[model samples]
Target: MLSLFSLAHAMEMAAASSIRTSPRASFLTSSTLKCGPNFISKTSIPANLMEKGHKRASLFSIRSQQSEPKDGSVILPPTSDSEANAVTIKDWEIGRMQDEIVSSQGIRIRRRPPTGPPLHYVGPFEFRLQNEGNTPRNILEEIVWHKHTEVSKLKERRPLIALKRALENAPPVRDFIGALKASHLRTGVPALIAEVKKASPSRGVLREDFDPVQIAQAYEKGGAACLSVLTDEKYFQGSFENLEAIRNAGVKCPLLCKEFIIEAWQIYYARAKGADAILLIAAILPDLDIKYMSKICKMLGLTTLVEVHNEEEMDRVLGIDGIQLIGINNRDLESFKVDISNTKKLLDSEHRQAIHDRDIIVVGESGLFTPDDISYVQEAGVKAVLVGESIVKQSDPTKGIAGLFGKDISV
Candidate 1:
């Protein structure tokens, strides 16, 4: 009796051979065998698989007879019908073997890395660095020394520590959805969640004003549902001081601290700076991470706007329980490309139905401007839209809001 492993190995080899002769033949044969942990009988396999199996067997037999036996073994003549069958099998096997070789070679080529620059070396007494003015260390040491310098400067600033302390004693803000619901109930449309971003690595300094409190006030007066303040000082040219200022300014709109959010410490710090919500980008975090962080957000009374980019991201986000709001980001993080159509693609009717069934609020984020742009996203089935450029650049940012909605939303 063949062990399961041996049977599997034989099947793999047979499949490989079939592939080398012809892809279609190999596909047909492989489809016939059910290989899952709970293996059903061949007859019970899917209809498509059965069709492929029949096609493979016919092809395999034809190919087998074409090649003469290498050891001068007597080639038994087959009847007319059997001759046809043998020829079919022979053809398929040859095609299958060819395919297997090509595929294996392709994989090997892909795995090999390109040859590049050669390594540099010096004699025992011949130090390259020693020849220069600063000659005490090697390349690796230089990198470490620079890193140490940076760390020393960072310690001197103590920004994160100050942020932690500020958050620890900070009072909690109002709920993000509650604020949105209130705005929407008062008016017919969902209110804006305007972001105050200075510079993005992708699209540099967006707002010259760069005042968090002023931006927060403008957004609130313009009938924004909430304020999303970017706090990444390095890439976004944002500061925690901006969040702190907006919180202390007594702006009516609930605040969302927009950060990269790789660590839990940031969440606690955001809460300390009077943030009502946090943006969690799904591209960087796994489902488990999102679930864990979301629970932490809830414990701190902070709403999480789980951001996804595509169908796979949406599916991953949906699998995790307790997600109330989903934000479809128009900008691709890896490529840094912005296409407002991304929101449309992700918010299909079927996806909308799934979200509706769970009572999830879908927020369209990035690359939005004008009443038409706002309407486009709203019609696509988002509960709200996040805008930055068109509104922030206006002479009267408050009027920019009315311009976007085509009506006074504050009323």
Candidate 2:
């Protein structure tokens, strides 16, 4: 008598052969194929496929006994009802199963190559929607969707184990959160956490000479409380190498790894790559994720700079339990529009009082240049400012920083 495991293994073999033979056969045999390690039969057979004629015959006889024939001559089993219900080749479940099999076997399946519409030169870059019906609801939704997709792809490519290993051995940088709190208490002035960014999707390339370590040193010399480094490779043209280099360059300022914070894995990865703090954009993340990630950052001895662009975002950041530094980004992330008035708009009298009561360090970000711009945001209730382009573009970025502050910040 055939053991249950042997019977299941035979069934799986039959199913595999049936799938290879015809789409019809695949549907007929799929129901019998069991999926588990214990399902593999311990039955012995000739090692070679060419020498297994008798074994094949015995398997066929067993299948024939299990499935009744329909006609005078022995008939093959009926295809599955689901297979019959399929309207077209594209809709066939058996075809999908075949694709999955091919994928599992590590085979590259390719469709027929497109024959030609002669490629014509387009004068300018054009935005064409691939699926018009599947439009995002708004700019915020669009960015969130993009972030989700990007993060999913990253997870597949870099598993969590690898990220943890990277984090465990990563170089350490200065802590932005600690620096901010210390500056606020000591000087009664918010810590100057300036960002070093090159290009943004919304606003092309902001700075011409983009050297991460050099920029970091300049910020340190200019009396910046911390340094924000863009570490996104695709959009920002940044890398972990930049963060590592900045830390190794002997710059004393705490470094914030400016990235789209989607997963806790990324936080660990940042810590491993010498990041002292991270920017958690309130626009994309829900409050729960923010709070959870903030706690994780604290546990890792890292700081979290919760960034907000509007009143709703600000309120959300405030509601989170452990946020110490609040960065008010003047540049609208979705529309790529920059307005200095955004700092003033969000930091109203009521909000200011609430922030002061909590002793939160508010850092004004983007569109800052010259002494007037710096003074404008400072007077409007921002204790510190994040300026990138105007300062970085100057012959000596350190001088540009003094020019913006209008006094020797180094002194």
Candidate 3:
């Protein structure tokens, strides 16, 4: 067994090997979150994807770096921030980048990615969301904006470096895509990624008596190939403790940490908490952030469920690499308007061909409440379905799975 110190060293060595960037890069020319190129220190780095040992790649290179660039080399650091600066800059920069990401993709929406570090804070680390035009507009947006504060607090309590060490003791990740594919081949139906959801903004308190472990066990017994646990505490009433408990309880189904991830630090945090996969909403994250974050997720050995609500987002995602699973959310995140046909609308033949060509497994998410709903998405080319309200609200979630498909899916 490795000690914590040994594990952190191993993670650094592995990170150095995995985090190579491109050399042919110039610094940013656009107006970005420039609070204190100013504030961030080495310790402020959520996870040192850019830093190899004591040295770090240039902020420029780290910002635009890709998983597999034609010219892969970490940029030379122009300068490092002071301890005060690092804290100030990161606090200012947290949730703002998501909006910037959306704009970079050439898609215009009322909502934007986090534009910069956390600027709306009381102290150095205690932060809040300002009513910037970049601020959140809808319930989902408000939840995301609030998450900026919540996650910053979480990260402040447990820094990225600490999470890296904890990962050494985490459960070995199951093959998330492999499980879905195997279940699909066996069931002749969409593989179930049964949702361990507690509450939603649209529907308050999915189950009055919510037991995450109990629901996860029921899903496993009901033949779910994978499970998704809502880990956000404010809106969803979920906690990472729930994820840890489900893992400790020893259910074999791989777990997806269903959090609104706005920063790379959340990826490492998820792995440390025993999550095998994490959600990356395309609606929320821009293309570059997705590319950068997805690369980080790969380095950490966490699978990404890149969620998209429409075609433009789908095209942007297909343009990225190392993405194996794409989730087509039937609900419009901005409007909270759900239409099951959104799956078919986005996964048209051209998109399906591109997805098939690259061997991407498409997942139909939300508004899937029936066998017909399941079949519709299956015919539309989804290999899996992420169902939450339909099953979790049922008295017996295990039987709910069978009723969902109009037959028993468990072998």
Most accurate candidate by lDDT: 3
Is 2 or 3 the stronger prediction by TM-score?
Answer: 3
- Across 1-411, the per-residue lDDT of candidate 2 in tens digits comes to 332223334555554454345543222122121111111111111113213222221111122234433323332232433322122122222234433533443322211111111111123211111111134444444544455567668779888788787776766645566766665456544456767877766667877677777878887787777788888777767777888788878778888888877667788878877889888887666565577788878888888888888888887778767678899989876666889999999999888888998988788998887778877888888877777777767777788777777766662
Candidate 1, 259-341: lDDT as tens digits: 76655667877787788899887765555557778988898788999998777889778888999989998876655677888
Q: What are the TM-scores, per candidate, against the unseen true structure? A: 0.62, 0.64, 0.73
**Model 2's TM-score against the true structure:** 0.64
Worst 10 residues of 2 by lDDT: 33-42
Name every residue pair that clashes in candidate 2.
170-272
* lDDT-best of 2 and 3: 3
| C-alpha root-mean-square deviation, each candidate | 21.2, 17.0, 12.6
Top TM-score hit: 3
Could you give the candidate ranking by lDDT, starting with the highest?
Answer: 3, 1, 2
True lDDT of residue 402, candidate 1:
92
